[model samples]
Target chain A: MSEEHKHTNYMRIFWILLTLTIVEVGMAYTMQSHKALLIVALVTLAFIKAGMVAAYFMHLKLERKTFIAIVCFPLILAVVLVIGLFPDVGFKLGGKHHHKPAASQDSGHAVEHK
Target chain B: MSSVALAAHPPSQEKEILGVSSGKMAMWLFLGSDGMSFMGLIAAYVALRIGNWGIWPDPTKVLAIDLTAINTFILICSSVTMVKAFAASQEGNVGKLKQWLFFTMLGGAIFLGVQVYEYSQLIHHGVKLWDSAGRPAAEWLHPAIQGHSTLFTATFYACTCFHGFHVLSGVVYLAFILIGVMRGRWTVNRIEIVGLYWHFVDLVWIVIFTIIYLF
Candidate 1:
């Protein structure tokens, strides 16, 4: 009985992943007009896929409920650091700034590189 | 009295080297650390992207969707086979274990093959790394692709290539365990640990497939 339950859960996980991938593809289609909405959809799909893998594929569900929290909390911290560091590192390294339009910024940076 | 009793009794579960099975729990902890590494990479992607939208590439156009979806399906199937291998090993069914492991290995190989082909195809179409110079993919000629495409290619290479590396390591890891099966060293507990790592790799790809390929 317990064995059968595991198999059924596995099937459910497969379907859930399939559905999430489809949503991700669908969102990609709307990139031209609804950029914000598409970004939201992409993030949502990525989160769902991440959740499924951790819970099902990684056996976090089978191991212990606490494992999920332990794994996720540190990841969230790493994300915070990445976001915090980007403005300083990325903009400083490039001779260009993201705030300005590419059209206006390109003339100097382009000539220098070429 | 001491040596004979210790040999006969075997330590209790709690009294083992670790409070839990040392190796299995250790692998889980290692994965926890690995999870952080990937998170850092993803965070780098988001930051660079938001900060430099002008130069980042459109992922949808540069990446071929259909082929990657197929690769995703292959990975999902491999996860299924991995679970079955664990089940078979528990029941002492050597034949089933070998069959499932074989399928899992084949799936990993196919994933790697497709990735190599994809890289070549991208390069052929002018998506060279280390400098998109002299490639049809990047130049000062077209401005739209410059910010986005370059960003897209860099992120694409970093994410997928890292994921692909994990897949390759997994293949080697699984092969070593398969060798154990032939030699009767493989056991249910051992396969479970291998399965843990295998599943973590699969999980990493799941996120990559959604973020990098589909959306």
Candidate 2:
């Protein structure tokens, strides 16, 4: 790519990212009450911004298919990790409702670092 | 001459992956694993916050957004400069490469400085790493801690500080690259490799900013 062309592309991406951020912040304030919708919008916009950076600024778009595959292959594990953790953390697994009151007070005992 | 010709025409199929360098491959793998670690942290954060639900203090009430918004813009701008530096290096324009790399480093430094300021502010506002019990503690903590969870301070500190460390290291990385470029020891390949790391830092910040500050 020519220097001039690369410059234009980078600048364009910067503007787009800036605009998206502004929109995200704006939505954060305006949509404070609509909790579910706000979360969806915020997360979706964040991902779009991430994709733009990865594809253009990082030049992943210019890379070959093999290179893209090599880089993306590990993300499968990441997705699985997030999914597997959601049930335990976010949802009540196995439908057995266990009311554990000590869980909150046990915060002090949490996260013992070696 | 016949042996030389035979050697030259030895391979018809592909032997080397086109345009993919070892440095890039390594960086990508590093970023991939680093990303997973970050994902784990974020997922844990989401789980903890959502599980607690209503007892947590509103993040906006406890945190400053205007300053962080500026910091986020600085990082985005730095990513642009980093990309520009890589382009200049590819063109073999040493002067532009050095200039943009320095600017990129400057941006990273400013971002770190702002983060330090934010951390100090949070600390002053009574955000502590943990109490004597190792649990997260904070001054602005809601009073309804009867049974719900309250680990906001811990999660916020862990996530932001990890990202701040990355920014600090990126600044150091760029500084070294700047010195090497001045001494003519670094090439376009080196800049490209470091650029991958720099951009990855910026990318992670985008996610962190959204999750921690925005929502």
Candidate 3:
């Protein structure tokens, strides 16, 4: 195995997670008003964390295709299930009036002029 | 060469039944079903909380993120150690595998320990799983405060504490595997199977970290 490559990846992931976590704290403290930005930031950071773990720690970069496929398929199915449950998940999270309606609804980002 | 060409072909259809081991397969299925179970709880919360016309809690405002963030690091570290254990086994270094397994177990224990501490802090902060200072949820501090509902705390404790229980089981699993290694019952394949379970546990935590703590 390429030891240096693994080391560099680990270090990079460490720095990225640290930076993102710091940003999370900063945003939490700084951002005010129930705006869309905070949610976007949190989710983006989450996906980044997931990416790093999958690539490095899980060795997805080096994993066999069959195993990777097995893992990925289930995760995809899961995301779909969660997405399908958006109405329920949305309410559980906070509510429509809690914010995001003006940004998410009809004639909003859900459907575009283009 | 004729021999080399023949080796590339698939094994004949009439062969022994072999695929993912039943135990490992069962574990994966269990994890998958558990994931759905959690998604259902969370989804129900989201749905009902929304329907409540803004009665639920603001997750970020109330959760002790710093403690949980450290918990995240601890769990992720365990995942790294687990893979290391698998790697050691692959390299035929049983001693290294045992050491890594011990560290992996240590990491898991630290996570559970931290979680217990966090729970204590929350309870002290006037939020118990079944009661918010002995008043109805709507009567407590603002629902937007994140721990408003007895329901909220109930789900929180149930979800995370259940996850912790799995981590504990994994600790025992590692112990069995370690003892097996000492008795030379382990093959590289066994390491892979255990590593797969460990990895799945870590994966579940990753999602839990996002939903429970961050999102």
All models: lDDT?
0.74, 0.80, 0.66
Query: How does model 1 fare in lDDT?
Result: 0.74
Positional deviation of residue B180's Cα in model 1 after best superposition, in angstroms: 0.4
Q: What is the DockQ of candidate 1?
A: 0.32
Q: Model 3 off-target regions past 4 Å?
A: A1-15, A32-35, A63-67, A88-114, B1-31, B49-53, B131-149
Interface RMSD of 3: 4.1
Among the numbered candidates, top TM-score falls to 2
Model 1 TM-score on a 0 to 1 scale: 0.81
Put down candidate 2 lDDT per residue, B125-144, tens digits, no spaces.
56664455554444343333
Task: Please report how far candidate 2 places residue B195 from its true position, in Å.
Answer: 0.7
Off by over 4 Å in 2: A1-3, A93-96, A99-114, B1-18, B130-148
State which candidate, 1 or 3, has the greater TM-score.
1
| Two-way DockQ contest, 1 vs 2, winner | 2
Which residue runs of candidate 1 sit more than 4 Å off their true CA positions?
Answer: A30-32, A86-114, B1-20, B130-149
Tens digits of per-residue lDDT, candidate 1, B1-215, equal 98788765444322433233566777777887887788777777777776666556766777778788778878888988998898888788999999999899999999999999998887766565554455343443233355454666677789888889989999999999999998887657678888888888888887777666654
Q: Write the per-residue lDDT of candidate 2 for residues A1-114, one digit (tens) a residue.
A: 366876788999999999999998888888889989998999899889988999998889889988888777766786787666654655542232345444533332232111
Instruction: Score every model by TM-score.
Output: 0.81, 0.84, 0.73
Q: Which RMSD does model 1 reach against the true structure?
A: 6.6
lDDT (Cα, tens digit) per residue for candidate 3, span B1-215: 87665565323312322255455555545655766666665555545444553455666666788888788778777877877787788778989998988998898889889988988878766456446348765454434554345566666777787788888898888889988988887766567667766766666676566656664
Q: TM-score-based ranking, best first?
A: 2, 1, 3
